[model samples]
Target: MVTRPASPSSRARLASARGTPRPDRQMAILLAAEKLFAQHGYHGVSIRQIAEEAQVPLALVGYYYGPKSELFHAIFEHWQGTIQERLALLQQVLAGPPTEAFLRQVVEAFVRPVLVQRASTEGEYYAQLVGRELARQTPETHRVLTEFFDPLAHSFIDAIHAARPGHDRARAAWAYQFALGALLHHITDHRAPTLSRGRNQVCAPEAAALLVDFITAGIAAVMPLPSSLSPSPTASPSPRRRAPSPSTTSRRQA
Candidate 1:
């Protein structure tokens, strides 16, 4: 019996099957999973599909990363540095008591990383994944958000509050959400170019400056809730009126 050399195509399949070993293996799975999860909702995709898409053995997916949820999480962990970058920028902006300028910087810090990522080929899938998860509001998605983002939100929200002292906390909080909503919508919104009749790209470079400007003014514009309206739970309580003295009441009666 004679052993024969494998064909190039056979070797290629073997290479994909072995899956680049270590870091590359994990990355291939991560990228495949990210694209699939983004295109189809989390529930809509499966572990086997990811393995096939990545062209790695099914068990290796688990061996390298674990279950589907963990793979989903790995995607975020892969990009954790971006969150840290934003946090660092945010802290710098927040170092001085927040000014109008700080508000713009804060908005830039919050929007730029996500926007730039969304604009890039490498990050496009991850951006889409984010948009879908937010829409689904699934338990897994909430878990990820809580683990990775809640702290960031609190920091930025506090920064916004610090930036504008006269405004109630509720206003500051809503303004944060509103700014977030604008960025999320802008990144995920597909109709912008069509809506603009080819005048805009979804991730146009100019849009970053414009987005920061728009969100800054919007944050600045968050008015305190009306006095007649009940205060938000976080709002400082209104003082009660002092009771009239009994002597004064008697004098009035007399």
Candidate 2:
């Protein structure tokens, strides 16, 4: 056979013809998978479905992530990392005197990151995913709450307790719950009908301040004084037994 050599362009074209996709395509697949998984529960979605939504090869899902479970975990990890970065930045800003200022900082730290994400293109979708997972109370979500969320809540509780010395632990816990409930509801609901009807409004930064103020006042109002610190009022002496009333005794003797 007559020998033939491949031209540089031909070789380059051959390489280009290979099935490998660009990095952005892989990211699109992941993003699509996340949206689907978030919309439908993990068990409700399939790799093929994600591939179709992402417009990538069906096998690409498994190629990028070994299994559906891995892919699910990856999506959560990615969102959590983004949130944590914002949290870390806020924490740095909060590292100072423990005053109302610090409390405001803490509140902003907790709320701003998630709120900012809520305003992004992916934020609403991802937040819905988080809400669904939270509502379902899945094992993975529970683990994330325990590992990431609970610690942050406890830290805030401790800070509040310290700032208000006489605050009872139970009351502090309740106040923390109140603050968290407000934030959670806002995120899950996004002040929809309430704001839509002009009954309520939610400004991200201002809401943070309001939550801190509401929680701090609630804690201050309900928290009981420490037992050791509470002073007992002096009681008035009871009427003297009258020593059997000397005049009455004398009359009885007569």
Candidate 3:
């Protein structure tokens, strides 16, 4: 979401509209919006239901965050740090000389931050919200992805091309899209544990490693790495984005 935080005066107006200022009010509204929007599609949630979920006046939801679309945009805006961190990790991997682990590191640079988010209490709802959005194809879904995620998606596809010269960039992009579907399904679908008879719990910490395995293998199918590369110690994979705590003030506004 390109939406940034409101100014202090804007916050004052938001609080005044509610007839009381509570510092947690805006964040509460965002959390509620994230949950409801994830469980229900964008069209399915109403501002009044969000207010009820957050235990705030219905008017406060509008004053604090505006309409449903704005609230949806705010969720991605609130997680803008995630996009930045992913970019930073990608650049770090590219900065190093290419190595045996080059493609795998590139995939991790893209995937780990999402998994880190899914594992956190604060980010779980948001992760599911993102999952819902990614699974759809509408003007709003296209807008959100194009505005907030397309740049990142391009960066990763370009990196994939870099790792395997002569691979068509368009194919690389499709590979990225496929990997994203698998990643999101891991978080949103609970059938893994059932299918595996409890051996493949998606919420378990090791599930993250499993996701990387599947994604890296899938990417290799699209952009096959050379058979003779050697691993380099300099190319360590993960540069994780630390999840925010409950009191962690958002870097942007709702």
Candidate 4:
């Protein structure tokens, strides 16, 4: 048979073609890692297991992520992007006039984006992962949580303060924390039997109104001095003299 030799250019082209699968393989590893991490806490997972789940070469996980901690951090960084996009939408809503009427809008802005995603499979998994991480409270996980949450909480405090200027800084911070606790419960409590018992409900539009009112009232109650400072409530009680005439009339009748 007459044989043909491959040219250097052809060999280079083949080599380049062979390299194209690398990125796809890396992405597969990440997706597998995310799923595994979601299902099993970080400590429960291993790189070898992840590589097997991804069906990629065992070396690729270390090559892409360096270590399991790095892989977890990468996943967290991806989640941060999603959080930033949602916060940006919230910021736009907050830029408008801040009023009691806007309180529900504010709550919805903070909450709806997260709750809306619960319908999707990936979102459900991600939410579960976040809950698990919070429960775990590993140092690495705590760092990620604080890094992701603290700024958002501070911004929310600013928004609350802007909406109710009479509120003091401490009270505003407390209100923000309360609002967050409520939101966190809503997100993490997937099996709240209280809902079936009619004691609590999640994602109800009325619950939005209830939250706005509850938070507003709680803040207002805690910061009563704000209202006390207003002229309407602070007006001095009209002074009254003793009814001397009535005493004299009673003495004369006796």
CA lDDT scores, all candidates in order: 0.71, 0.59, 0.73, 0.61
Candidate 4 TM-score, true structure as reference: 0.67
Candidate 2 residue lDDT tens string, 59-157: 556656657766766666667765566447545644553333444455566566777777777876677777676555566666555555565565555
Residue pairs in candidate 4 whose N, alpha carbon or C atoms collide under 3 angstroms? none
Off by over 4 Å in 1: 1-22, 96-99, 224-254
Q: Write the per-residue lDDT of candidate 4 for residues 102-170, one digit (tens) a residue.
A: 444555566666666654556666676776776565777766656666566565555556555555656
Q: Output the better candidate (1/2) by TM-score.
A: 1
Candidate topping TM-score: 3
Q: Tell me the tens digit of each residue's lDDT in model 1 across 1-254.
A: 11124556755655665645456666788899999999998999999999999887886676666668878887887888888888888766655442325567778889888877786776778878887875566677766777777767766776677666567656766888888888878888888789899999877888888989999888866743235533466755442212111111111100
Ordered by lDDT, highest first, the candidates read: 3, 1, 4, 2
Q: Model 1, poorest ten-residue lDDT window? A: 245-254
What is the RMSD of candidate 2?
A: 19.4
For candidate 3, write residues 146-170 as lDDT tens digits: 6778777777777777666556767
lDDT score for candidate 2 against the true structure: 0.59
Question: What lDDT score is found at residue 84 in candidate 4?
Answer: 73
